[model samples]
Target: MIKTTRIPKLYVYQKVIIVFAALIIPVYFVNLLMNMKGQSFIKQEFSDSIQSKAQFYSNQLDDQISFIRNQQLQVVNDSDLQKLNFLSGTLDVFEEIQLVNRVKERLSTIQNSSDYLLNTGVYMKSFGRTISTQSGINKLPNQEYEIIGKLYSNSNKSSIYYQGGRLFFIEAANNSSVIVYLELSVKKLEKTLDQLVGNYGYSGAFITNEDFSYYISSKHDDSIVRKIQDNVSVEQSNKNDDSHILKFGDQSYRITYNHISTLGLSLYSYMNQNELTGSLKTFNIWLLVMSLVSVVIIIVFSFSVKLMIHNPLKELIAAFRTLETDNLDILIRPKNDIEFGYLYRSFDKMIDKLRQSIRQNYEQKMALQHSELKQLQSQIKPHFLYNGFFNIYMMCKAKDYETVATLAQKLGSYYQFVTRSGADEVPFDMEYRHAMDYVEIQRIRFSNRIHVVAGEIPDACKHLMVPRLILQPIIENTFEHAFENERKGGNIHITVTYEKKSLYICVEDDGNKLTDERLQALQKKLANCSIVLEKTGIINVCRRIQLEYGKPSGVFVSRSEHGGLKAEVIIHFNYGGGSDV
Candidate 1:
């Protein structure tokens, strides 16, 4: 009787429910996560829209500043203004007044055409005179002169600079002949900025000079501007795009900043986050309802699968459990469900047929067991007889009478031992003699090139039973494969020994053919007997011995002491204390 390992029992319905739970639990969590993630994505899109609006406002302000800078450049680069050379002192007072009037006319033309500029003027330090777009006598206030004088010393050909909270566009003549200034109105730009972003969400835009003196925007609160400035420094410097987020007074604002390099001004816009993601609560409620409905559907699907698949499978498995215990009398009744009805009927018919075939199968197994030895004998006998007869024919053709007679007699004795029909086991001495006959025949064929040596077997182990022809194929394998052209001294030695009720028969050769790796591989193959044993005659012999002695007995190969192949057989048996069994 064989003890079988028990399988952990599980019901089909329980397994199906377990699989459903495994699938549904992850889907439930994933659905909830997708709901949350979808809401987050919606919020992100809304925030991105706000940022886009902020960017739009920044671009509008940049355009306005660019327009103003272009106007200033046109006035600064006026060809008429460039031609006025004030260095010549030869002009009289009338000529000087004429020069100043001509400059004023050009300034008035510039100021009238530009909508953003409040006034355009030039202050001449070389003559200590100030000229404006106005047509009066060219006199200016002392306080105004003081401010313009300060601007004259520090201004360049760039955009308008702000000083004392007032906008001024100042440009010096190429020859330092005059410093041009355009005083811009902050109030007007503030109104324009309001109009630009007034229709958008809680949004405001501003333009500021680098010195923080002059600024124009819809709102004047410094906190929001400071937040924008602080966050923009980190975000805009690392990223080329001009959008960022700022938190001020428990409110979040998406701020965008754009730098107009031509005018040296920074444009900024701010928008509130609350206005962007306001409808998220409604979306979340809808997501919750959808998630609940999905869970209900999953529960219903799990129960439906249990009724449709699990119950029928459970009944089929219960019927098949009888086969596990060698009880084929059990039958599977046909199911009412069409899916399993045919399967159940077929299974019942199979069990009935299996019961009727049991006795016939037992008789067939007995016949197979009786034929296995005959098959083994048949596999080796014909091939061996053909080779033996061919060798005798060669000896006779060579007219070697002594060798022919000796080989013919040995061949007859070898076949007689191999063809013995009833017994599969032979005594150690008979097996050795059968192996020696084959080896001696080969020795005669090879003549002086081969040497064969047989050691004395122990008397106590002589009659111990071993599988037939086990040793002869091993000895024959050496002559067939192990010898090479380089090996002039081909030596074969057979030895038998006994220890602790186990017999070891080793056949070795000095052909120097078995390398260490080859020896290890052959030994491993013999040890792992799961392979097909029909490849070599020696392997078939090894598998036969293992099968006879309940798998603890088999042939093994190793490196010989003479630096060649060594084949070994380890067989375990009970000895009657110094007596042959």
Candidate 2:
């Protein structure tokens, strides 16, 4: 029986919910997406209809305005009006009076012909006199007279003006200084605007030119009108006639604007947003209710399944609990459920034998792994001793007593650290200091040929209890193998840093002469989880880190930024006891 680690996976009930959700979620979202798309189409169609209606009304008003303007033109050139103006001095007061009455009759006839017309006025420039159908034959220099004269000059050939809350059209005579002005019925224009927005729950419509000098409207809600003016920009309607939506007072509005080229004004049609999408909103609510029903069904089905499987699953859990207590000899009798009975019967045969084999195998395997880890850690004694004594012999032969003294001190301290027993983990600062001692020994041996750049241990990580002999072996491997053939420019650097619950140690070298294939092979050795069986110092350190911390906490090797080998060691403090280091 092989001992394997158990990773908690999804349970059957969880899978059931996931499967049902997977089946229902697409239909839910598909219906939602369809509703969204349909709302878009419906709004577009509604906007198109309003756009066409606006255009139709604008053209109709344009034709009416043009007809009124034409009638005013005809009266300007009428023979009776010409006599009333240039020939008024030659006629007697009675004859002039008859001419005035005749012109008044013509104006009255024109004003009464159209429902949109208000009143017409004739300015008699030659005598400073004016005549009108509303206030017939008023004397010269009156308020209406002065207003007509001012309006005639300020019309600026634009043919129209607004004053005193009324829209007016002014046309001058062809052969005289006389002018004829027409006042359009603002009330009538307001009625047209009102008709455009008839019966809306909350709505308004209005007509405005570039001047906005006169906004003809049926309602007097200034706030809504001002909001519409600010939010709706109709300058782009010549290119695309898409209507816009506006939010006001907890209500959304659909606003449409169409430019009237003939009258030089724009008509804006406003209505409640829900007025157009009431049906779709109802449909969306229905879909939401149905989707909730589906979720409720799924939840109810999950409870039903739990109830159906609860007893059998309880029995199976009890059986597993007996195994948990190492009571594998406690056999579970078959239950009434056929499938569960089959499982119980099958497991009963294997439980006892499996229990005995697993206990023996697990104990042996753990003992072998722990023994291998200890051997790797303690193997530092023999190889390091041989090297230390040989280096001391070389210094003695060179007659360098000063160098010999320094080497002896470093060697004694380095061995004193490695030869200690019982403590498998030491403070990180101790490990760091011991690793430095090994580097100092190498420094004395190689003299000016090796430059080891090392950083101080961070204060926060100094108290961490880490596995013994972890950092020294990697540094030794670097010095022994990487700088083996190099005589100059040999460099070694070690660093320490921590993130969250993890400690990172990186050792790098610049004197490495490793080929790509050999480097790759070495990297693969460090990454492999199985015991390497090879007793190389770097590989042993890699295995030791893996044994202490679990997966994803180990040694990794890559090419360094300095064109050499870089080895990184990662240990998780959660697994490697934080208090112990």
Considering every candidate listed, which one attains the maximal TM-score?
1
Question: Can you write out model 2's per-residue Cα lDDT over 46-162, one digit (the tens) per residue?
Answer: 777776777788888888888888889899898999887788688899998788878988899889878888889888778567888777777777878677777766666767777
Q: Candidate 1: lDDT of 445?
A: 62
Model 2: how far residue 151 lies from native, Å: 2.3
lDDT scores of the candidates, listed in order: 0.71, 0.78
Q: How far off is residue 314 in model 2, in Å?
A: 24
| Ten residues in sequence with the least summed lDDT for candidate 1 | 572-581
Which RMSD values do the candidates have, in order? 19.1, 15.3
For 460-578, candidate 1 gives per-residue lDDT tens digits of 88888766777887887888777635447578888889988888889888886667887777777777654664545666667666655546777887778887888888777642111
Per-residue error for 233 in candidate 1, Å, reads 11
